[model samples]
Target: MGDFQPEAHVKGSWGLNFIALICKRSSAVFFAVSLLKSIAQMYKVFVNDKPIIFTTSFKNEEDFPVYIYKNTIIQELIYKLKVGKLNGFYIYSNNLIEDWKDFKVKFKVIIAAGGLVLNGSKKVLFIYRGNKWDLPKGRVEEGENLMEAAIREVEEECGIEKLIINKELLITYHLFIQQNEYRLKETHWYLMFSNYEGSLTPQLEEGITKAEFKNKKETIEALQNTFANIVMVYESYLDNID
Candidate 1:
């Protein structure tokens, strides 16, 4: 009882006081084991139930470990995670579970992607949002990295690729919860330059009805009725007459 571990259990030491001691020791060991297991689950990027890429561990609601499990089955886990009582997160791989103190993720990360392509003297791109004109951006798929998904979305939504990234824009957005559901989005924008000359192709499957190019004057006109973030960075990449 003085030094008991769940990983080490035995029969034939069936005393009442001894049982109590062993129970206490095994409790701590179980907590630690479950904690490690939770950590191991986060480092995977799942695509259709299979892992494709290994990124920093991300947490879902299922990872939070309960106390002596003080609160209840679900409530205690939720309360512990929300109040930061159980802040320890591990990044496990292969057969080792290591601590991940830096990138402690929240729950439900959704990434939206967009890119900028250049065409001749004009530097412009097209985007289509829900029933509105906007940048061609969509959610990143599981097991896909930020830039890879971004490039794919651009190619699919605009029918253009072979781009050279100028720079990656900031990932910014808001968080809101719906009825009995919670979701968070991490949108990473990019400025990519491409030399494709095919006609603009809007992804019909995604409801992208139009894809077009614009000159400086037309780009300004297009910017007037677009997403807020699109307009914010539109002028930064304008064509300069030398």
Candidate 2:
């Protein structure tokens, strides 16, 4: 139903030995192995708040849930993706969906809005939230619209101004356990772009650590270096660009 999108990348050389790009939504990791020489510019994709997948040879083929395939055997799979032999990642959606609620006692749903701001080429602006790479977003405040809250969250987190919400992206839902209770968070995502380029000052008071821009290549590398949500977002973006 949707076209697969190949995000534009600024190429360079940086040979990653072996990479494991973890996915968030389905608990799978779809990835490729490459002999990168040097890293030029790059784009960073953060799902929820982790880096999962990255590559220099990213292409949009047929849309497949193939990205969500997982290898049930963990040790063997990690060994393969680490030692530079496996060229592809096996994703298993059932791994997460089947036992996802076992850890939760009970949960309540909440509404939130967030922004995915892409810079030049395929570079995206992200903040180091707590210990993870994340886009700026938060809960909707009283007297504020969802979009308004989305814009406000980005500005407060990244300390930028005047973000133009381009296109709306897919909404993602997951349950979080806080204070011995489950909290359901439904996020409204937007493809937000802007012309203002300024210093990024993460709101440390709000738990943000660092703020920076990563070109597509660096961002791809971050997929292996960071967490899983990043991979899912990239795949989602690939689906979006499609």
lDDT: which candidate is best?
2
Per model, how many backbone clashes are there?
3, 28
TM-score of each model, in listed order: 0.50, 0.57
Candidate 1 lDDT by residue in tens digits, 168-188: 644434233546544445466
Per-residue C-alpha lDDT of model 2 across residues 118-227, encoded as one tens digit per residue: 87555787878656677777998888887999999999888888689877775545445568644657667788877767788888899998877778776665565443
Model 1 has an lDDT value of: 0.48
| Model 2 lDDT, residue 125, Cα | 76
Runs of candidate 1 with Cα error greater than 4 angstroms are 1-107, 175-182, 235-242
Q: Which stretches of candidate 2 lie over 4 Å from their true place?
A: 1-106, 225-227
